[model samples]
Target: MNHETKRDVFEGLVEELANAYIALDGEGIGEELTNEEKQAYMKDYDAALPDDLPVIPELIGKYLIMRKHDRGDLVQALDEGTSFLLDGTQWESVQDWFWFSDVKDSVDTFARAWVLGVWRVEETGEIVKLEEEK
Candidate 1:
């Protein structure tokens, strides 16, 4: 699927999951949920999501490496040393590069990188570069 379509699907899935979670009861799996339980669950979920979540485009399930092109930047080399994976909610290092030791800073920090390529799996289960698919 195209990036936009994939993004839409992913967002729909997230909404569905959130709704399902909210509908679940605190006691039995199928019982009616209390308002307190729903509130608590929503609080935790909202806390986990980043404040800048909307700025994150449809990069879910993508693996990538980015390099800064600006020549005047002194930390360019360090920025290019690690690969990253964006799993909907957060950005994580694919390698042990220690760039994002603080979980809160990882997503916003990675967003600043100049993306070299995005790798995603096809419907047939083969992984390919997004550019090559075009």
Candidate 2:
């Protein structure tokens, strides 16, 4: 999807999740949910969409691409540039994957690859580099 489309989808997912959390018990209480529960909630939340989400395995591909670049493997990086994750949310140094700066900016490479991003909705999603951001 294009930048605006992706942003809209992302925002829509967030809003839908919020609505689902609120509507679940009709008490507007938010609770910790597993990634699976969250996605399932989204499907029911946005009944029009019918639970069409990318599989979590896609994140592995993005991680591998980032790992190649992190290791100074330019050729591999270039080959995978078209479909890699490189937002501040996913990687720390464009070449390195870091979970986030919340923990003294220390990187747990394994965690980075496994946990996805700062935001749950965009966890396994690709980064959309818009012209303004670039």
Candidate 3:
């Protein structure tokens, strides 16, 4: 995607995350939230849904339409040019990743990659490649 679209997608993702968090917070499933707080959170969340908020419906469903395949977020959400299609694809980003038997599968070490960003696979090895907004 072009920089403009990528920028839009990135911003959209931020909003999407905010809405999700707000909903979860509004649920007040934790013991920390007071009744008033829950009410206030829900009030704001509901009020924004129908507002002039930009809802990228395509993203509202699924950001990528590519065929089913392995996917993950790794340690955190990746930015532009970091994530790509297919499993183990990210290993290509790491020069020495081939040393590990399952570089594409998991990283037991607390690794850091300046170019690819820092991450370690907790359960299973994944490229953490999710489809980008195309």
Candidate 4:
């Protein structure tokens, strides 16, 4: 997909996420949210529908969609070396992520790219690619 299209999807996801976050924060879920709750909330708010389109709302969901196929359990696809569709274009740190304001927003960009099924592994060992739905 083109850059503008990817960006649009990412922005939409961010808006959905923002709304969900507000809802959870309003419900005080964040104060004592379990891992399942967090994950569910994340999916509910952030997960794109089957289509590669994001819901366009007042605000967009802005978070990281980490590399799916990684050596970590957070991303099962990466761990198993399987290709998955992003549905939308953006990803947050699905497994483990820490937020720091000092560095460049590479993490953010990476997340966005993740949604678009774009990722770069420092070392070339196995191959991960994007395959659109048939």
Clashing residue pairs in candidate 1 are none
Give me the runs in candidate 3 sitting further than 4 Å from their true place: 1-4, 25-134
TM-score for each prediction?
0.21, 0.19, 0.18, 0.23
The window of 10 residues in a row where model 3 has the poorest summed lDDT is 52-61
Q: Order the candidates by lDDT, highest first.
A: 2, 1, 4, 3
Candidate 3 lDDT over residue span 1-134, tens digit each:
11123345445646755766666755553234567866755555443321211221121112122222224342332222133434333323222332333434223221222112212233442223223335
* Model 2: colliding residue pairs: none
On a 0 to 1 TM-score scale, where does candidate 3 land against the true structure? 0.18
- Most lDDT-accurate candidate: 2
In candidate 3, how many Å is residue 72 off?
44
Q: Per the 3 Å backbone cut-off, how many clashing residue pairs does candidate 2 have?
A: 0
Q: Indicate the residue-level lDDT of 117 in model 1.
A: 31
For residues 34-94, what per-residue lDDT tens digits would candidate 4 score against the true structure?
6886676555544433333222111111222223323233244223323233556333432
> What's the true lDDT of residue 101 in model 2?
27
Q: What tens-digit string does per-residue lDDT give for candidate 2 at 1-134?
A: 23233445567768767876876675655565679977865564443321222222334445544554366343444344334434433432333323332333323332343233211224545442212212
State model 3's lDDT: 0.32
* Candidate 4 similarity to native, TM-score: 0.23
lDDT of 1: 0.39
lDDT of 4: 0.38
